[model samples]
Target: MIQQFRRFCAGLIVSLSAFGGFAGAAENADLLLSGPLFPAIETFHLENGMQVGVVPDARATFVTHMVWYRVGAADEASGKSGIAHFLEHLLFKGTEKFPGNAIDRTVKAVGGNHNAFTSHDYTGYFQKVTREHLPLMMEIEADRMMNVDFNAADVDVERQVVLEERARGIETSPRAQLSAAMDLALFKNHPYRRPIIGWRNEIESLNVDEIREFYERFYTPANAILIVAGNVTLDEVKSLAGKVYAPLQNRAPAYQPERPQEPDELRMRQVITVRDPKITNESITITFRVPSFRTGLPGENEAIDMLSEILSGTTRSRIYRDMVIDRQIATSAGAYAGSGARDDTTFALYATPKGEVTLEEMEKELFAAIDRIARDGVTSDELDRARKRLFANAIYAQDSASGLANILGRTLIVGNRLEDIRSWPDRLRAITPAQIQAVAAKFFDPDKAVIGLLRRPIDFETASLKKDPA
Candidate 1:
């Protein structure tokens, strides 16, 4: 009996190992050597000059219709910050063919979901629904693309909504407020300094005419890409797109000049204090300019990504282990590289210092970690873990229909091929520890960083009164 049990245990171990190996192989298979594993997208140009991309996936019963416009907050003029995001909200208010709430009602009745967002480089609208609702989704999206009704009353309503959103997303959160301030102080000539939701004053002052003009100028077929995925054939998508978007006349694309580079940081530190009754603790955010996705060298970009992961990629990361868990100086600490399409981007180190631990102490430890990485470089074990985590995330990203749409749309907007997305992991895997250290030494210079602090306000009035008006 003992001999039989041992044999069975050995067989079970072999079976489990085989299963694990097969699973790893399946995940790695999606990491294409040359391009994405997805079916070759059938591209078409409609009569109205709108570009269409179709990827047919018949495994699921649902479909995703996405419209991507080659405009974002970066397209906003000096004073027109947040107009792109504001306009995103206005598109849903109403249109000539369909009144306000008509599209929402139709989508809800069909058990579908719809939403849109604006970024630094693009704006997009998308819908997920049963295959039979493809034509309806396309028709409604096309109608709003060119025929949106930006009436005065609707503008007023959405303006308030956006303001409330800003208050929640920016005003109430010290971290977000500090981030906004850092951007404003960091970029003097670039539109990237402008907030995506626009400033409170700008949103309040934006009128109906400005909104309408922005719509007419940017929301055209020539400046847009339509992507349809899941539960549909290329022919069906093309036919539906032709009937819906082909009638709208195309306009010439809008043009914007390249943003100028930011000057060298002149100060070692800057502080911003916001006194709110609801506030509890102090926070610090450090930002440095790095090569953007558009112009970064192949190795440089990968190293930057790896550097971010090594410092703040997970709870086991250096910052979390040293500052938060071991020293107990900070509640949280991490680093991140902002994902953008420009030629220059920002890398940030943010932390919320704990009680009795000044922001300066937290900053010291954070920089120490960066300095150590620059001097000694990351270990092979660290590199292997980072690569494995990144690979897992890549596979997980493919599972979301909307996420896939956004990835493809954003990449195309930035003038990159879909293959670049698929080949990212192999590129990441090839990065050496020496390259990662070199990138840190090159870009993460303390003198080149913008440090902003949010703290409790001092009681100046009470202090002055106590000093006999001195």
Candidate 2:
């Protein structure tokens, strides 16, 4: 049973290890992994300024369509915190052709799933269904593009729903509280500090007209990108897009508001801690202010990604092996970097304290691991293993059309080009251990980092979970 569990964990590591530049060269092509994430992706613009990216895959049967709007929580004005997310919910309420639940009912009737998400830099809606339903998906999305409407009743109802959602998703969780406070310390004046869900006070003030104005402002064809991946041709998607989205004239503003930059003094450091009975083990996370894929140097972004993987991509990774297994201080350890945001990115590492292991000790050990990387740099063997896992996962991701589609959509929304996707594998191979260490030494400075803790109160007892018993 132990060996079986280890095998299962090993398989997950092989399959799930991935990064922004994960895709690799085709099979038997000298490189370790298989073909590119999307071998051929064609992009074109409609007359109304909607950008469309089509990735053709013969192996895929169904199609995945994603529409990315260039506005999200950060775009909301000072007073209207949650309006962007509220508008996202309201969009589904109804339109002239597809009234309340009509669009959802149709998609369900066709046996498809559809949903939307609001993020710090963008809002997106995605649907995956049969190839025959592609036209209907585009048509309904195009309809909502210009025709969504809501009455007073709908507005009040959704407002309450959004508020209730906030209570469930954020307010009730101690970890969420720590995250919010940590960001507040991390970004200072930057809009990224504002929670994606907005504050309860601000959300209460969100009304129909406010959301309508915001919708009219940012929800234009020019400010959106459409990504379609499936067993389909570029010409078919282009023809369908021309028939549906071509007529939408650009109504969005010509100038985007330049968000306030994080002050250099934001180069400062701080710590935040939250306590709750619900949380037993002490949780600690260290976050650094980093650069996004577009904002950072080309090789630098990929290097940061590689650095994260080498630090803790799996159970065999440095932090887990050291802090969790060898030191027996932390019950769990992991690290990840988000390279998709527009203005900046965040690279964070987190761990939970094992029984009788103080949070302070765990924090010290975590930094010590980071310090070792900066001082000695990584070995070629470690780098090679990390790259292999990365390359392998990229090959595996090819089997999912929606996953490829998401890569294209997220890449474009964060201000990268289509060619970036094509060149991902090449760029990743170019990242050296020196480059990884460079990011480590540069971004891991204590001055520019934020540390957050989900500390447990004295006498708090952890639930039925062990601390690296293996």
Candidate 3:
């Protein structure tokens, strides 16, 4: 297992190890192990306002070309929810230069792959292909950047797909339902409260012109990030981009409208419960609104990242060890810090009870664990372990070209600097126990939290047995 993990990282790394322009060399071992992630990545901007990040990894044969637009579900016009996501589906339908799925078919013909996704803060598209096909990828992407051509019929077809997706993903799944409810509770005024997939009724109402208008508004050179990662150099990528992307004009506003901010004070704590007949596992989630990397003070985001690692990043982590192994009240327990968003992010804790343990029992233990961490702070040993675990994960993530591109693109689009990503190791290492405790005590206030319980209907087991008994 260890060897396989290394292989994946190394395979991914062979591409990423080149980010620092080091490639895989015995001479660079110490630097590779100790230095910042992507130590040598090159970032620049076109005259047209498109930002570019180039990570050259010669160990890999192909490059992962990614274009990230600084727009997503949160940026949608009010009542036009899901239009951002809906447009992601339609972009592939056609473009003026390469219409009718020609771009996708062309990539496959060359044994390459392509896909796109939309999120709360951004939308992105990527393709992986050999060096020889790099310019081809750039050409088609640049074409679509300004020239997506979808008809009304295409919009109708894709709208139904989005609606069905919401039905299948949000309405039918208890977990998704719980998450949506929690977000609505956690973010009262901020657009973050809106689901990325949009509300079902709004999705149904989304029209063709809305999709076209949204695409034209947000898909500008200024609002996009072009990331080229793999066995390629800055000069090669720059040369190709100069030909393909340089001519594109910026059509977006000089400044995007500011997102609505969450109020300074949260007046109440919210507890939401969702009981689904199909749910077999009962779990509770406690989420607190916290500052994202962009909004956090110096060392705040890093400390939160460390706090989450110490809490439940591994099986040996505090929450897991205490709840699942020592107390034996939970089948699973963990906490995560969402430090990546453009605005405020989240720090969440969740646990599933073992056997007949009540959600109330699990909730009590979970909150106590968080309280203990906030009050006592982590020991030096715990701090050391967490730093190592987080650093190791960072190292592993750096081994893939696509992974490097994702980290670079996502960080850039969310109003964070490239140095913020490159300096992650040093920042993570610099975090102290007191800093972690400070964020813990500060963000996890009960008055500002959202708690969710998802479980089977009250008599689900009884009903199941009554219906199936022989």
Candidate 4:
């Protein structure tokens, strides 16, 4: 169970693919995507209000289909922290029409791949199969959407599975523990602080009634988006969707995402330290709250994305070159701007010290590097290299049709339009070296930071990491 969960989080599937463009915008998506007509983007809505998006790639004979539900960790009821995730597992358990492993058996027999995933803002199920099997994929997905069997025994069985997942994924690892602690300190009132996997106590206590209510509420047509990418046309997709999905009623409950609002995080330097016997390398991570794609201006997301690359994206990155190669204070150092977020996001910088180098020394050196970037700013050469690399990767990403499908699914799910997904390169290209430095100085404030340490228990004993805090 632990091994399975580790692999899941390690790749950390974020369907918010951030990949290629919509082949052509559907007529309905033109108003929603809100821009000039794009070449291959096709978007529409079913009679029942389920938004459908198509990205045609004649290059391949296979297709990737995704159904995204607008419910995730942030949408669960207060005491039922893991219900959204639990439902993701249970949804696969069966429905009356596709009873008892039928979905899995059929997919395996067809030589297709299928999986589901959950994140802070949404849960999604997807299947990839040859173009000829697209309708069959739709039939099964559409059937399960309306007829999921929320059996009591299934709930109890999956509850234990989630507990095992949490234990293996979070409880045993020092880094995972540190990351969870950092989340708790980062968001004040937002449900983003809660682990998408849910706490063990909450997972154990969640019952069938809560799961059923959640399923009936957030899994409706109005709350779902269907994304198809491959050798197919908008017209064929519409016809198929009309037959398969249009039957599901577009019922809007009184539920609008009533998530808690997070207050301004004004505190300077919150800290969480975890001591575990299994921990080998002592590490420190610094997280700063930043604007998400949904809130930031067009250029802001691109600027920060470039900023992460310029800071610590490669061996040539400033932090890596300075600390790992020149100064020899750490073995590795990297910076990242969190992606696929609906609300606010965090910018993270992490490093692990080399032998005989104290974590204190590593911390001082790491901060000095960030402070230098904030103070003097970065040069055009560094900026150009980072920008070129980002664009190059974006171009490379377009090769995979399924990859592009994943991107479209994530973009639409996160309250973003298809136009911007198509225009991602222009935005990244427009980001200036000054803008990168500006976001650096603006977001990397020492006062608005959460510092977390994952250290060996012996080191904690010698140092001052005395007590564990809630």
Candidate 5:
């Protein structure tokens, strides 16, 4: 199965903050700093240039084996918009050795589950099985990594699946339509503007040759990372990987992402309106282009993260309290700063009005809330509370071994070092109130914003009639 598009542990970051654990924040930080973020993560490389990370946890008997390819939709050729994701679907068709549906049946017969996902920066496939079946999973994944075979017929069938997936996920959903519009307006030249699933026309035009070329070029040991987390030691993983994955040779030169860079001065504030008859409840979203962790200054990304938490990370957050609890104009409101991309990323605020409130009213309130923070800055209490919650969330994230695997894979694939991941706790704790206010004032400018509106066509007609009284 192709998992939904999610960057980092966005759900974990937001949902875990509301739990009570402030007293232990400092203690947890001290404990984590005493060693690696989690216990015993041993990483090494094969002669074929494949990097492997082994995280040993003996609490459970199951193991999660993941292979991450360091290429994604952002690395596609100019006209080949959807090739990265389309190839993801095709990889499951079959390999010459595994044959048709053999891998799927083999994993399921053992009561294991498997899935794959594609993002702007990487694509990954993972399977979870018991320790006894770990070697089998590795052999299957290793086989397909080099020997994935597909015909024109397979390509056609999977292309239809990809198209239907796009329809079910994006075409029929009003919010998805609005999000697509916002991306098109938000990014002027960067490939981030393209949908990860791809545009409909471009997807229809893709052929088997293009996909085969892509697979041969990028799907090599040199361009991939293997992450195994569960009941296994570094020595065991090293032995199994040496036997199974070591023989695979690199087909291409070392992986180097030649993605076109976003211009330094790409600034604009635009409105994107998406009206569909299916939309009964209207909403508004505002997105601002901000520096990602890979591109920002020393403390910029951390400050943006703190600012997001203080603004609307939970029901008790500033925007939600002001709109839903105090002013009573919105039913829901929140904010997110996506700082994990390879290039510049987004900071977004969204609101759905309560009863008969107009988008204009909600937009004004949202802008006012942000402007107030930019001007007055956050109080010491708010800063302390936000930092504690974030710190607690970081500690809680280590509970799942698979979750740690995901964090490691996403961070490393985007050109970050493991030390950066280990040092994030201290860096986030050190963020000051002035720094948060400075980023809020700097990136939340009117000129760098993209406002998205989703409404029913009937609402537009009604508003037009009221404005002119015709």
Candidate 6:
């Protein structure tokens, strides 16, 4: 994973340098258009009710084909926490027409790769191959749209795999445990409180029938979006998609009510102690509820994003500069704002204090930085630097076929148009210093934040002889 991440970062840096020259022009165009700086995408709906979006970039011979299902862990019914994720795993097991290892064998034979991921708002499966294989990839994805074969034995095997994943991801890590607890404490009735991997007992008890039911309900053409990007013309993609995906009939969209709003946090703090011999360090996480990408108005979401960047987008960010570098109180510190499809979101700060530097000291500095931003607002220079970093990162993302597919699918799934994906660099460039400050002041309130600490257990001695004499 670390190697993969390093490769990804390296590739991003190269792409950013190459694309930097286009930033000024893109920003100017965005200002004139009132939204994105790029031309509109060619979007059309198939007779089967599938929405297809094409962004014809003929820069390379590679094409990215993605099928995005508009249901994720958030759409799981009560007592069905991990069904969505389980279905994601099962899709690769087999299908009616392709059966067994057909997808893997064929993709590899054609010099292509395929994968999928499940999030709170959506699940996506994609493949990247040469333009010549676009039609074959599309047909393979469409074949498994609703033709997955789920057996009881397969369910049992995958369930254990998920359990092991949870153990590695949450159970064994103190930080992960604290994060899960914080999420539960943060939301009272929202499904976001449930982990995307689902609870252990819930996952263990889930059967084949439940998984199949979820697939039938949410994996319909109407609830899915098809994105094809690469060295292909819009007309070619449309014609191929019509032939491949138009056969599936539509189904009624899933209907769910709005997520219940979380009440204002009067005062909440949690301290979790883990007893593991291997544990030698402690960490802290502070989370603040903010607006989701979908709920906020145009540019509103960007403002919060800019605020997060200003706080701890990089080593030069305020938190890192103050706590990690200047004072040397923390080993590492950073901030994150989750851009998802819900109305409410979280802005989190994660830190690992230096030895003998108490979590209290770390929390003090973290809150102080946020308070300063809320009071004085960020400077124009700080905001501009953050914006430039984001723009650079966005440009860097254009190199990877998988990254492009993810960006398009995620933005569209969250209710934004596909055009927003191309114009994101321009939008990041246009955010003003004052706008970042305004959002910081509104959403960075201490009262709305949840502070959690993970630490080793404290030792205590108890009386013995004195009590016996009494």
Ranking by lDDT: 5, 3, 2, 4, 1, 6
Cα distance off (Å), candidate 5, residue 77: 0.5
TM-score of each: 0.85, 0.90, 0.90, 0.89, 0.93, 0.86
Candidate 5 has what TM-score?
0.93
Q: Write the per-residue lDDT of candidate 2 for residues 350-452, one digit (tens) a residue.
A: 8898888777777788787778888999998888777776766676666777877876776777567877766667777788889888888888887767889
lDDT of 3: 0.79
Kindly give the stretch of ten consecutive residues in candidate 2 with the minimal lDDT sum.
1-10
Query: Model 5, range 179-279, lDDT digits (tens) per residue?
Result: 87888777878888888888999999999988999999999998999999998989999999999999998898667887776675877888889888888
Worst 10 residues of 5 by lDDT: 7-16
Candidate number with greatest TM-score = 5
Query: What would the per-residue lDDT of candidate 4 be over residues 1-470, giving only the tens digit for each residue?
Result: 11111111111112221231332321233234333223486788887778898988889778998898877888887888988889899988888778988999888788898999888778889899998889889988888778897878998888888888888888887888888888888887888888888888888888888888888888888889998988998888988899989888855642346677667744468878998889878888888887776667667767777777777766777889988998887888977776557777777888899989877777777677778877888888887666555554444455677777766776777677877666665565577877877777887787788998887776655455556442
Better of 1 and 2 by TM-score: 2
lDDT of each: 0.72, 0.77, 0.79, 0.74, 0.81, 0.71
Candidate 1 C-alpha lDDT tens digits along 1-470:
00111111111111111111222433354343235434445667887767787767667678889998878787887677889999998888878888888988888899999988777667888899999998889889888888887889999999989999889888888767777788776666667777788888988899999999988888999788898888788888777887888888866564443666666544344555555555577777788777755667777877777788778767787898888998888899988775445446677788999878888887787788899999999999887776665555555545555555655665666555656655565677689999999998988878767888777766788978998966
* CA-only RMSD, every prediction: 10.2, 6.7, 6.0, 6.4, 2.7, 5.3
Error of 2 at 314 (Å): 1.4
Top-scoring candidate (lDDT)? 5
Candidate 1 local accuracy as lDDT?
0.72
RMSD of 5: 2.7
Regions of model 6 farther than 4 Å from truth: 1-41, 254-257, 265-275, 422-430, 459-470
Which of 5 and 6 is the better model by lDDT? 5
